[model samples]
Target: MKKILFIYFAIISLVLPQSQNESGYAFLKNGFTARNIAMGEFGAVGINDLSALHYNPSYLALNNKTQLAFSHHSLFNDYSSENFGFSFNLFNLPFAIGINTTKIDGIELRTKPGELIAKFNANYFYASLSSAYQIKNFYFGATIKYLYENIYIDDSNGYAFDFGFNYEKFYDNFSLGVVIKNIGNVNELKNIKTKLPLDFQIGINYNYKYDDFEFNPIIGYQNYLTDKISHLHFGTEIKYSQTVSLRLGYVSNYDSKNITTGLGVVFKKFNIDYAYVPIKYGLGDNHILTLIYNF
Candidate 1:
């Protein structure tokens, strides 16, 4: 038992971030869509949905249909985000594009009691171009992004890159994936400079089939360069037929809510998904709604 504990701690020590405030653009760490958020943000691998543009671009190689996806995230403290993504295949290769914007409003700016001054808002925008190719059982992918952030009258912009790879044997029901994200930093507020929330993640997925029911389970680990903690994520989805699914997920080494659940419904080429997450400490809960169209 002692030996196992030591090994676990050693792995954590190697993966955890060195400091909490070491990076900027923290919002980039937020999950992309309702389905991913429902899966406890275990997006390092699996399923290869359109949202893979934000997680593991290598999964793009698995795309068999063109898709467009949109998501709305309702967060606490008057903050919210809107995400849009599209994935398609051209010349036997897959490409994905996405944009995300987060905003916070309703601030009370006052210079004196009972006196209202001016209200201000902050916004963050991210745009990305991603593509993936496969050679036999190995898949490779890359993404390039431009990030812009503004607060009041001040704004800044930067660029970043992500690289990913996936390996699967044609006859196997399991796959492994790895990715490195946010390979660049940002310069904000003229004199303030900070690093992006760089992360390294690795994960695997297993698929089990029992008659007409299908089950997918995923396990992953993520290391952030900006904090002193590592994340362990687990996700599972049970599917009945071609139109319905239930998803459950859990995340360890988190400061807020760690469990997530979601529902998915598909009709023809359209899909709808919803996720419910209860925040800890009564801060507030989060609700994510997503719609996907496949062609």
Candidate 2:
């Protein structure tokens, strides 16, 4: 099984950018879903979908339903990101997988008229496999990922790992979650060696339920091993009739953004989400859309 996974990962890696403008694999920092992005990337708790493969793997065990999720990012029309995720159960244990691809388009070289080398394309790709198991009130999980990038004619490849744990007791309204990500540098560009951005995060959330409405308040802290920087994230979600939700989030210590908001709608087993984020430094704003199906 492991061998098959590695082979599949390799094939996917052949096909696949940045926030904070630092770190070797900065594209990995991009959120995979509008729901998560609107929630300040807070995934320490209250998450139970295939997107968990991009955040806290332990969340996979929270649900047994098979799920498929996809998202698209419109970043000022300069670049775009697409993400796809799937999760299911095997032996009563939950497993999840995902892929992300980012493409930057439209560039012109200063040429007299028309030059064959006037424009080029750049891309980034990520593929991850994750699984989680539960013991009593604790859930533990891990994910292995393959990272690849192509810039003009140069390309690079790398590997990383994510570990996560969640604690949720039955009949409890609160949960705690923790994750360690980008642990190893399996490979990199031959010319210039690089390292993944190692991160450690812990989050907690409390759910308040009454009648058919629900509200969740979340907070999280993230520390970076490579840059020695830390960030605080805050978010809230309000659900009505278990079909509609409104989300708001705030993040501290950022270069070009701080606040995010989103809306979500559920129909039977289908979920649709949208988020709006304003970019600082006059970069305009970002609009993200996500779709999910559970069966």
Candidate 3:
């Protein structure tokens, strides 16, 4: 019995990953997008008009006026999250500023001695300040983030950066965007040094609008520098009557990914959107609800 206990302790000590400088436990995709993880981080091609800061800061540049949005997600049976953002323009300037945050609502934590400690309340909390500048059809922006998290006994705090650009030309029916995220790391864990979940993404969107119908198609790729994970996603959105919208999307990379579908409705200056993510496995099925007030 003593031999078995010693062996177990040895294994747990190595696997506990109590230091930030360690390499195995890695900072991963702990962000706030239900569609992002389910649809392969493909939100750079958003079908709705809220909280585009997840994929590209430049996407929020379209807010000609102040806009605020909130989203809630049931990430599984026990884990959940909430996302909120607000963006606005200034006078006739070509600059914009936005605030974005994602909070991990509930995570249970227990002591290593097998005693139940306290719940994490939030396993991860991230707040970002984003800004953009546009010249003609070209827009560029970036985000600075503050992160705080406590996972079990291993805690890490870090800063991350994101930069992105969007451009369109010719008939203005085609668009392309590029975004790079999490290129820096300043982990305040047990004094070890590591990196963020560095990534690069490029996307294209095209659409046609008429009196009665609007159709949009989007494609994007994300390359994760940490683990060299590259993924592709494709999606389309359709709108009719100018009040209702539907979305369909696909992702490539995993053995099986979710089929993303969503519904949206507009009433005067307010927009309500809901996304259904058909994810099984550890994530289970997820439903996201969003509210946006546009001015």
Candidate 4:
């Protein structure tokens, strides 16, 4: 049974997304909202919603309204997550809070290949507080996060920090953003320490509008410092009358899958978004949905 458990853990370490089989806390690298996922997870720039708290907090300063958001992720291999976010202004500064919980149930525990001994569930969670400040057209932001994970009888906890900057004065309708993420440490689990997935990203986006129609195109580069891996992200969004949207995105340099698509609808102060991603190797597909309310 011990040997089987070890093998299971090794496989999990190799298969989680965006980590390149190099880091722990895979949930941290996953997208926090459906809109961002549908847009190739390109949140390093050109995002003004509460989802910014998970990517580039600098973007949070662009909105003046109080907002609340909730998201659900149905990922491959029985993995699922629920997320919550709240964004508001206090003391003339934009601040946001976010929480994520992930679970994998009915994992088989067996001593050998023949029979099952039992079953267990894995759990992961994180809570974060983020804030941003703006000077002229430049924005700077920071986030503090608390992370926890449990699998079988092993559990660990950690803390991390993220910093980001954005410049919106490039050309008309153009913006640039940069971010550094996962700068912190975690305690050991079962006498073995797990490394964080440190990352750096930069991106540019253009917002074009004519009458009641809008188009946004974005491209970005991401580097996983801990794993020495890199990837490219690109996406576009089309909107009509600010009420309906279509989004398409592509990611490069991944082993499993690359294309993503989604939709959005807005009515008064409420908005909903959905995203779809197809995974290779029969790992199943990913579906994400999010709802937001503004006050």
Top lDDT prediction, candidate number: 4
lDDT of each: 0.80, 0.80, 0.62, 0.86
Which scores better on TM-score, 2 or 3? 2
TM-score on alpha carbons, each prediction: 0.89, 0.87, 0.79, 0.94
Q: In angstroms, how far off is 107's CA in candidate 3?
A: 5.5
TM match of model 2 to true structure: 0.87
Write the candidate numbers in order of decreasing TM-score.
4, 1, 2, 3
Query: What is candidate 3's lDDT per residue for 1-295, written digit by digit as tens?
Result: 0111222234234323444433322323533443343333475544235455666777666544577777787655555667777766566532333333333433434435555445434355677777767788887778887766654455667678889888864347888878888766656444445456677888888878888888877888877766577888787777888788787777777654547777678899977777776775655666777778887
Report the Cα lDDT for residue 285, model 1: 86
Query: How many clashing residue pairs appear in each of the predictions shown?
Result: 1, 1, 2, 0
| Cα lDDT over the full model 4 | 0.86
Q: Model 1, 36-147: lDDT tens per residue?
A: 7887777877855888899989889876558999999988757789999999888878899999999767544554566555665667899999998888889888999999
Worst 10 residues of 1 by lDDT: 1-10
Per-residue C-alpha lDDT of model 2 across residues 1-295, encoded as one tens digit per residue:
0111122223233232123333676677788899888988677667856788988998888765598988999876567899999898888788888999998675443324444334555688989999998888899989999988876566788788999998985457888999999887735453555657788999888889999999988899998777677999999889999899999999999998999999999988899999999997766588999999987
* Best candidate, TM-score: 4
lDDT of 3 at 281: 64
Considering only N, C-alpha and C atoms within 3 Å, which residue pairs clash in candidate 3?
Answer: 21-192, 21-193
